[model samples]
Target: MSEVPLPSLEVDVPPEGLSIGETARATGLSVDTLRYYERAGLLLDPAPRDGGGRRRYGSADLAWIAGLVMLRETGMGIGDVRRMAELSRTAGTEASRLAVLEQHRERVLADLARTRAHLAALDAKISSYRHAVAEKENA
Candidate 1:
């Protein structure tokens, strides 16, 4: 089978960068969420603002926002996300960042184990029901 290409949400970014709305569209985040992230200090310092006070997001900002989105979607808490953002601002904090990611990975692994156990139990019940029905029909 041929692999299908996913539709791109990319927009043409001008030299001046994109407006807050355009960024929200490109990043799949709401305008309010973007504002909240800025206010919550999830973003790096001094995100570019235009002369009219509108937010201008450049490529670097978009990439950082994508990382933030990935961490959040993976069930990272806001506090941890904030910590990761803080850690990113400074140099030589790779170890700290790795620790945070490692902890989250542990949680994800535990959840996966529980989910697999649940799936096994469900499959066993399903097989038993199928066998019972077959036995009844044969008898």
Candidate 2:
């Protein structure tokens, strides 16, 4: 199947910022998960708000949340992601960020190798099944 491009994070979030419910709807994440991310420090500080003090999320915030989702899906630990988020808040820390990213890349590579091996094993089993079926038909 052709790759489906993800919606532009920049476009989905409004300049004025969206409420928690809006963000959840845009990101396909639940309100509870968004709150959990905030509590986990995975998100940077949201924009300040008016009376009633509702959290407002801008485009940048949505972009960051999308990145967090990608990281989590790629097997990054929440603690590590939280640390990365803290590091992002610091300026002039390219070297530190690179180190963390490199470590994560290594882990992902290892995981990919294991996954490929399992897929190969499954493929072999499938081939065996096909051959067995063919032999039964011939006999």
Candidate 3:
């Protein structure tokens, strides 16, 4: 099957910034998720508000959210993600952030190894079935 090209998530923000809906589209998150992020204190800085009190997201906000999406997709829990976000806002927390990522890396590596083992078992079973069928055909 041909692979379909996906739209780029990296968006260039204009001077005016993006509205909540625009940000949601750019980040591949729902509008409700954006509001939840605000209430959950996952953002480094509060979202800026326009004259009418609508949320406005700038380039930095989009970049940060992209990272959050990646982390979540990789199976990082919400609490850990929130911790990383909190660490980002403070000064001299680089080591803490590194520790969090390193821990997640280890977990991902373990999962990959387990999945590979399962794949190997499946391959061996398929090979045995194919051999049996070939012998039967010869008979």
Show the colliding residue pairs in model 2.
none
Q: Candidate 2's residue-wise lDDT over 26-122, tens digit each?
A: 8888999999999888885644574679988887788788888877888999988988889878777657867887999999999999999999999
Instruction: Give the winner by TM-score: 1 or 2.
Output: 2
Span of ten consecutive residues with least summed lDDT in model 1: 1-10
- CA-lDDT, candidates in order: 0.84, 0.81, 0.85
Deviating ranges (above 4 Å) for candidate 1: 1-12, 125-139
Per-residue lDDT tens digits for candidate 3, residues 1-139, read 2321223366779887999999998998999999998889887678999999999998778878888888888888889989998988877887898899899999889988999999999999999999999999999
- Which residue pairs of candidate 1 clash? none
For 27-118, candidate 1 gives per-residue lDDT tens digits of 99999999999999998654799999889988778777887888788788989989988987888887898899899989889988999999
Candidate 3 structure, TM-score to reference: 0.81
lDDT pick, better of 2 and 3: 3
Ranking by lDDT: 3, 1, 2
Per-model TM-score versus the true fold: 0.79, 0.86, 0.81
Candidate 2 off by > 4 Å: 1-10
